[model samples]
Target: MELNQVYFWTNTIKDWKRLLQPDKYKHVILQSWQELVSRGVVCIYGFVIMPNHLHIVWEMLEPNGKEIPHASFNKFTSHTILADLKQHHPQVLPFFSVDDSDRLHRVWQRDPLAILMDGQEKVEQKIEYMHRNPLHERWNLVDSPENYRWSSAPFYETGLDEWGILTHYKDRF
Candidate 1:
């Protein structure tokens, strides 16, 4: 088996579903991300949630000297996100349901595209790329990178980390 120290992930929904068909849904997803980081389950390296998908750069930290397996974290986050979405708004029921195969609710794509990040350069580059996604030619939600609050752009711009979870990137910001 291959071993990697760091990984980049790109996970999407089935059929490119746009249940984040609106802005509030996206905000809720962002909030969930912040909550996870605050609890110390992971570090928020970078992230951008688009209308239909999201891009994130993060590190799953070991707990009490125990390594956090990537697959398990992803599954946990998937469940948490779905549960929160369902609890906050009953509107999500039309899109997702329990899967018979695994006997669990499946919402995200089966697997994510993971690229191991080994060096500082790769890490920095991925961070920049994630920030740029919200400004693609088709997307005009912001005039500048920092204007997008869904991302860590604001902290990078002002160094005023409204969310405590950004401590790891304070220097970079």
Candidate 2:
């Protein structure tokens, strides 16, 4: 989680709910990354958005104001998702309700995993793992890694970053 260091990060939804099954919610994640990258807060190398969780290969370039980039990401996405649910998906709100004093609904589980990737090999390994995740038997989301739309696999395979949110890992490591 150190600034300017690459990390393999994973964050999951509360209770492993498939709240991200919808395309709209996934876009919420993409938008957050876009904002972070555009502002130079982070440099994303790879990522995948699964049904209930997400994995990212990124480096924190700098703090976003008073908050670290990832923390700001989680907070913003959580707030946006909560607002969307309250407005249009009220029925789904109960599933995320909690007794916490700070918030009524929790979108993301606490203590996300962030492992430092100290070398090119580790970064490549994590990127490969994330790219192939959609093809795993448990999910079977796509026939091939690059076929998954919500991942950086396609960018790696074709050198195309449709969303302008990714940086080539070689540029850093």
Candidate 3:
């Protein structure tokens, strides 16, 4: 399929607010995100990391000469996240069923919402909406989106980050 826009979303295995999960696992999710960008899978556009869920807007890249049915950044991260969660959070084991194929019902929800931004207007609008998500009606974590370190807002506003981060302020990483 031709590549353009992708919104990949996933939630915690049990909606357990592993939100307070130590910074240790922060890399688990972020590393997987960086890997995709590093491997030419997607040109990340925007993202937001809520306590139990995440939403990402990426411009899926179809590099020349690559052969694959599809390059789903979502699929790769889903597996990595499940693996990471299982390793770090085995307490939730009983909540899921493991199958012979190695797939487990570990995702809080099968899929949250992976809508494609089919046009420039929608893409721009989604980008803006995602940036302002932290400010939505009752979602008051901060007075401004840039105050949230887990989202791309700060990356754009202050250019401060710890590791591999591709944004308008990639130098922060």
Q: Least lDDT summed over 10 consecutive residues: which range in candidate 1?
A: 62-71
Write candidate 3's Cα lDDT for 70-166 as tens digits.
Answer: 2344355456656765798777555555453756555445545667665556656666676786677756767888876667777667666555555
Candidate 3 lDDT score at position 11: 47
Candidate with best TM-score: 2
Better of 1 and 3 by TM-score: 1
Arrange candidates, best lDDT first.
2, 1, 3
Clashing pairs in 1: none
> TM-score for all predictions?
0.72, 0.98, 0.66
**Model 2 segments more than 4 A misplaced:** none
lDDT of 2 at 139: 99
lDDT of 2 by residue, 15-127 (tens): 99999999999999999999999999999999999999999999998999999999999999999999999999999999999999988889999999999999999999999
Q: Give the Cα-based TM-score of candidate 3 against the true structure.
A: 0.66
Minimum summed lDDT over a 10-residue window in model 2 is located at: 162-171
The list of candidate 3 runs beyond 4 A from truth reads 6-22, 63-88, 98-102, 136-139, 159-163, 167-173
